[model samples]
Target: MGRVAGKKVFITGGAQGLGACFGHMLADEGAKVALTDINGEGAKKTAAAINEKHPGAAIAIAHDVTKKDQWESALGEAAEAMGGISVLINNAGIGTAGSIETESYENWRLTHEIDVDSIFIGTQLAMPYLKDNQPGSIINISSVAGLIADGMMLSYNSAKAAVWMMSKSIALHCARSGYDIRCNSVHPVFTRTPIVDPLIALGGGGEEGEKKLVRQIPLKRLGEPEDVGYCILYLASDESRFVTASEFKIDGGITAQ
Candidate 1:
């Protein structure tokens, strides 16, 4: 497809699942990818695998998205490796289950830091590069819980919801400033990623818990990683140049009900 042939993309949480899917999807389409994850070895493995498929198309970095110093270092290195930055995918996040009464302030703070603050840090650090690149995009991987609410997912829901709105704010700022940096959030429902494993464990830990989730989804099945990754790919590419300050729901039609 060569959708983003010359684009340079920096993705957090790029070692696996939707992150790895984004790498494979974009590399296959001819984009240069910098895959960053907390698990540095895993990131290296994922990047190596991508290079095997599309020689010289990828590099892996050991990045902790929450740290400002690491964000600066990662973007600097990624820019050097790929020539410049054209896109940022703030895909690193975690889910925590707890009602307001049960969730500790510690967990709340951590969830917001990982899921929400990292986006802010990454975007702020990457803005200069993105502005220079022009016609770039930022895809924040939020969740359907961001769009709605869940009794058991208070921390995760709040964090993702913050991301959802934060994306819009950044989009508006870029537009007003003529930065050509479109921003949008993707809301996926129960994608079969490791992120959902805790939920599975909380609900009987097997196909049964997953089935319960699928039952709520009209599509009657869990989403695949690519389902969200390609949607992100579109937002990352110029195809979405006219689309910003919006949310894409890869929720298997769940929100329709």
Candidate 2:
């Protein structure tokens, strides 16, 4: 249960959905977590619940990951709150569905700002704090769409692909500098989160839309928040010390096709 004990984690989008799940999983494992999201009130609620369970192990911050100033401030505040930051989970993203032929520049820009730019900003700002820990981990929540392409999800595909490549670049830099700060990306196909609610609604609400999506997955089921949460736990822990610059696909074997 205490896999990440003593580590201090700062997670972006740590208010609800998969982000809140990550906060819960980490806090339960004895890590003092800083939960930051645009929804400050929701993030506070999430942190309060975790603190109730773990006692003084969490804090919530208002954050807009696209803004550099906010990134810097959040990192500083979180580092102080937990003594030093050891793990940074760049989990804030948006999935915009549109074809390259029809997607507007504005839609594409906003998609990149949240899905791609945030990872860049968070990694740059969190690097020094992670270096201070000697061995730290940065988990970027990419998508299986990063590995493969779909005609309708143009912006989402582009953004996640950028995250996949960026993680490798950061991993190489950390290794050459001998910091032992591991960087990697986690790619999930689809899961039970608000992000997929629209699809479910389109599928007539409930499991119908998910059924169509899962047909593409060999596992024959959509993912749970805890599915991704457990993976983050492994990477945040020293168990994955030697694993860096790689991509972990939680796509229910979709990539196997």
Candidate 3:
């Protein structure tokens, strides 16, 4: 029942989707969690729900990951609330698809700001606390778009690919510095999350739409949130102590073909 017992985790973008799912899963497995989001009230509500099941195991913090001041303050508050930070999940991001020919520079910049730069800032600010809590884990959520290419997903593809490479660099740095902080990136395919609602809408919004989305996936289905959550659980726990600087693909064998 206690997979991450005594671990303190700080997760960004925990208002909903995978972030909230991860919070619930980790807390259920005995980790105290700090859930942060730009939607402050949403984060609080998620925290309250988790606390309902496991009282005092969850806290909510208002945070804007792109801002240095907010990152510093949020990490400090999370550390104080949870006693220390053993896991950091850089999960806040957006997926706006646009080709370079059609995408505005502003949109590209915003994409990189949230999807790529936030990881750099969050990891840097949280490194000290992670170092303090030896055997820490840093989980960065990338996307299959990062590993592959889509003409329409120009900015998202670029940003998430940056995250993929950055994670490896961070993992190597920690290893070189003798910090037992394992950093890894997770690449998920078209999961049944709100993030895919737009793509679903493009296909006319129904089972048929989902079928179209899964056509390329060898499994012929969308990924469940639990699919990625279980992987994160392993990385967050001591079971994956030797795993670092690697990419975990939650895609349905899309990369294989």
Candidate 4:
């Protein structure tokens, strides 16, 4: 049997990038997947592709993770579509690069709302369904920037750091309340995603710049979406029943060095 057989997973920002990768991977493992994104058309397109591959296994909804009402609506829809939500992946976020002094208050607010507040909304909205499931997982996507300092990504770093702490807090609350839900965050270094394409373009995309970045890693390679997807799968599955309140670093020794 697959790791997530018969499981129901709800993922935010699932139309593209790592979120899309997660949806595909989970559906392949026999899970019923519900994906939501701000782009309703993109979500529909992704759902179509997933359904074509997995056949009646996935659904998509439009959701703005920062909005509590949207979270509630999305959760209700997901539960209705997939039986119940056993896993929630808070994957919607944006990146900003600028020194603290140079970063505007508007940028900071946007970063925090998308990266940090989304986690709060997703986790809180999923709580009712998760409570009923008795052994659910809430995985928040943090970043290596969250764990370590990076130049010119002040707002991004701050928001991700908050996500890391929020995961821990929710895990503690669940444990104390005797809820069977588990919460954890995954911190990954530069993974190739649509969000990073612009940065790569600016740096001269190809082996030249790729080699430069890879050299910083002991593994000598950047992470793939599936690399993080598999890590999330393990955490979402029963194999990790005893694990909670942890940070899984998929940074290829970036943080270790």
Model 3 agreement with the true structure over 1-257: per-residue lDDT tens digits: 69999999999999998999999999999999999999999999999999999999999999998999999999999999999999999999999989979999999999999999999988998999999998899999999999999999999999999999999999999999999999999999998878999999898888888888999999989998889999999999999999999999999999998
CA lDDT, candidate 4, residue 233: 86
Taken over the whole model, the C-alpha lDDT of each candidate is 0.92, 0.92, 0.95, 0.89
Cα deviation of 197 in candidate 1 (Å)? 1.8
Provide the lDDT at 39 for model 1. Answer: 91
Model 4 C-alpha lDDT per residue in residues 1-257, reported as the tens digit of each score: 88989789998999999999999998888888898999978888888999998898889999999999999899999899888999999999998888977999999999999999878777877899999876899999999999998778899999999999999999999999998899999998889888876666656788776777677778888899999999988988888999999999999999988
lDDT per residue for candidate 2 within 48-137, as digits (tens), equals 999999999999999999999999999999999899999999998888889979999999999999999888878988888998986899
Task: Return whichever of 2 and 4 wins on TM-score.
Answer: 2
Provide the TM-score for each candidate, comma-separated: 0.98, 0.98, 0.98, 0.97
User: Between candidates 2 and 3, which one is better according to lDDT?
Assistant: 3
Could you tell me the lDDT of residue 133 within candidate 3? Answer: 95
Write one digit per residue (lDDT tens) for candidate 1, span 48-100.
Answer: 99999999999999999989999999999999999999999999988888998
Task: Determine which window of 10 residues in candidate 4 has minimal summed lDDT.
Answer: 196-205
Cα lDDT of candidate 4 equals 0.89
Clashes of each: 0, 0, 0, 1
